[model samples]
Target: MKHSEEKEMIRDMARRVAEEQVRPLIASMEESDRFPEELVEIYGDLGLLQMWVPEEYGGPGGDLTSVCLAKEEIGKVSLAASTLCANNSIGLILPLLEFGSEAQKRRYLTESAKGRIVTSVAITEPESGSDVASLRTMARRDGDSYVINGQKSWITFAKQSAYMLVFARTAEGKGYEGISTFIVDCKTPGLKIGKAEHKMGRHGAPSYQVSFEDMRVDADCLLGPEGSGFKSCMRILDLNRPTVGASSLGLAQGAMDQAMRYASDRKQFGKPIAAFQAIQFKIADMAMKIGSARALLYDVAAELDSGDMSRLTLLSSMAKCYCTDVAMEVAIEAVQVHGSYGYSTEYPVERFMRDAKLNQILEGTNEIHRLIIARELFGRR
Candidate 1:
């Protein structure tokens, strides 16, 4: 099917699921810090969990644009749920689909599509953060298996995931060339999950510290080839970052929607707030920013689907950074237009604002993306 039709279908499905399954539980989920397993299952039944997997692998074979549109719709309702879905769909599944062996795909992707397993990507260490190549995690070869010993931090869904796509150093080297990727079951003997992190928002999706002490995995667990993990991870990020931007766009859209409704209904100075010039200007700015960001996100997703990977890393970074920043700005301004009511939990704008802040930090930090964009613009020659 054509990409546009696929996107529309996914969007409609996601909107219905979000409203019926996610919106009803947002309050309690956030308050209780619970993962929405039921919602995940619903999405799985709708083929969203495996949208990008090839049809031969028991998936819908949807393009990246469809994935982004679905994520945007889900994000409009619950950022936490949208984030968990996006991470699983892109950060975990995309790498495996792109680089895993046929046997590996058969083993994992099939189960993952059924929502029988949850997966996470482990790259950031307590000491590494944005300096991915400087990671200290080590996996040394021992006969047919490698023994892994390291600590990974800020891993989303780590505690609940059934597997992790781990990046570790296999050789003593100066840079990314030494890194390799492996698929490790969460039940591995030496893998341990630390306490869940307390965060500003998206508390429904918890982050955790994962420690690997002498964990053993067979050579078959290796993804792609040795010394290729960094490139694989980068490629996955390029394809997925547009969805992150789309999530931000979703939050911005929700904020604008709430603001518009509140402005039109709430009266002040004997008139509807929306009728005032000050409120009109804020609404106009929010509309323009959201529209522009949505365009950029969709454009990048389309380019990725066409296999025009060139310049996309930079464009994805740009979209992620710009759209997220705009999300935060628009959400904050939306609250301002709502007055004191926006500050209370009774309103969704405050939650939208909190959710918008998270997009600036995930996928890749906006600060790191700026460096990437600058390098691309100036030509790394």
Candidate 2:
């Protein structure tokens, strides 16, 4: 869990921004499920928006570990803020850096680093959540363009993005190879963005249903080779899942911090709850879980930053699954320690509990992650 001086600076900067800037917006966002429109520019200015993009493209040239540190610190204050940072950095910027053509990277990265061309990745459909091969969206090749037609569900920030990376079925194949990704402009004629979902928490980062009714993008818009999109995404997610773990770790830590503070001050039976062995045990367990999960997530991130993919999938899934489960447990215990005040919005634990649930569901449900982990375990033997 030790960090370099540079990374320590990055974490501190993110924490300051979260407490001073992001905390002020949470109430409004939770009140109305508002889109975090203001966060994009703030993240961009701070270089958290595209932390992994190289410096040649007018970016900060930071790595994924730096991004994770930023996410964890920011997450302690706002899951929505952390989610926004992750989605843009992992979902779009990383792909563009790894797979985009030179011209595409120059254009997109420059725009993105400037916070001008906000981005979203569209992959999931109504029928396809964990099953990427089951996607029904079609992008048929035409003379000079491809016409895409299908509906995408739960596309985060689709309405706010100027450009979207849309994955669709481009040919007939039994496996993931049939799919392709197109960088479609959101203003393209046949694209429609629907209303955002009202989730239990993280309302600031909106997820919407997007429809592509014959939406056309030029031939050059296809990212990487034809039919390589799904595989490339699998590679990216190997990096992404662990970053989600980082966010969850922050949430668990934040809740633990709050619980400790409350237990130290709140009195029961003419004494503070901190004096009670039961409350002390709960706090002890929370700290233990958070510490272990942090160690795992940080190690996974460091391994990834070293450019080693041999253990990436298994470790990433473990990080995602374990950290999120820890977050859920810690959030609930933090709530329990608060007694009646926990259920009320008086303390942030209620919001923490609500937000903690979504981390388990996002980046693939924990059930799906377990299957993946098991599959990898046996497949490697």
Candidate 3:
């Protein structure tokens, strides 16, 4: 089969799994505000947990485009699940793939590819969410090992993951150059798992605070060269940003699907709401936004896969900002089309609306994305 054919096949399978297995649990998971470990295991079973891992490691060795396609389908049903699936392709996985020692790769990526473990990354601190240069986490070299001490907030899958990719300060310096990355086992001593946060949306997946007090690890745990982690993190983000846009695009598409069904079934004055020009226009606009955002998202994904960094930074920010913004707009319009029913839990539009809001905030705020895009266009003048 051609690449596109194979991609579509994976997408169809994801949709079937979502409809058959995930849809039944969405309501209960949303009500309870609990992460769905079963659903995550389903992803592992489907080989999505290692979708990006190289074939040498017993993975599919797929590209960012394939990852985005999978995310788009899973996100259509549950953003929480999509977020979990995306973690495997983003922050932790890429750095390890590029810079990890052969032993480190065989130890971590191999198990992850086999679905024997889940993973996460710890980079966002309480004080240094996006201003990574100001992170206060300290990792002091202690003779063949590093003693790490710090706290990380808003970490997803921290409790569920077996390992975490941690970034900390290894030298006294002003900005990103002093940072280093480490692969720390979650079971390490001096590591504390804090309370899970009750977030507004993606209720099926919980974020948490993680604290490391005198957490020590062998020098082999170091992922890359000393003081080069900031660049690694940025590289990871550049690669994953388009996948985030794909998730948002999926949410918008899902909202539109619900709206169309509701509009067709709902009737007023002896006619379906779909007959009304106002409803027609809204649906038309929703489709247009989704189409446009998808184009940019896939374009950026291809560029990222091609390893052309020249235009990727700017293009990725455009996709993340525009696509997520479209998601918010389309979700709200979906709710509007459904009227009071949309606000009610009976309809999925309200949930989509709530979920859409987060895409704008996480993976770097759309505002920050706009700034990045602008800076790229105008330069530092």
Report the number of backbone clashes for model 2. 0
Q: What's the CA error at residue 343 for candidate 3, in Å?
A: 1.1
- In the range 1-381, model 1's lDDT, one tens digit per residue, is 135565777789989988888898898877978887776677777887667767777777877788788888988888887876645666457887789888988987777767555678899988998888999999999999999999999888888788899999998865899999999988999999998888888868888999999999999999999899889988888778888887788889989999999999999899999999999999999999998898888888777778887888788898899899999999999999989999999999998998888889877899999989999989956
List runs of model 1 lying over 4 Å from the truth. Answer: 1-3
What's model 2's TM-score? 0.97
Query: TM-score for every candidate vs. truth?
Result: 0.96, 0.97, 0.96
Instruction: Give the CA lDDT, 0 to 100, for residue 298 in model 1.
Output: 81
Q: Which pairs of residues collide in candidate 2?
A: none
State each model's C-alpha RMSD to the native.
1.8, 1.3, 1.9
For model 3, residues 1-381, the per-residue Cα lDDT tens digits are 124888888888778877887778898879987777886678888877778888898777888888888888888988777777746766456878878888888877777787556678899999997788999999999999999999999988889888888999999864889999998888999889999888888887778999999999999999889998898888778778888888888899999999999999999999999999999999999999999898888888877788787887898889989999999999999999999999999888999999999889877888899999999999835
Which residues of candidate 3, in runs, are more than 4 Å off? 1-3
Error of 3 at 92 (Å): 3.1
Which candidate model has the greater lDDT, 2 or 3? 2
RMSD of model 1 against the true structure: 1.8
* Best-fitting candidate, scored by TM-score: 2
Write candidate 2's Cα lDDT for 30-140 as tens digits: 898887778777877888777777788787888878988998998898887888874566556878877888898887788776754567889889999888998989999
Give me the candidate number with maximum lDDT.
2
Candidate 3 clashing pairs? none
Can you rank all candidates by lDDT, best first? 2, 3, 1
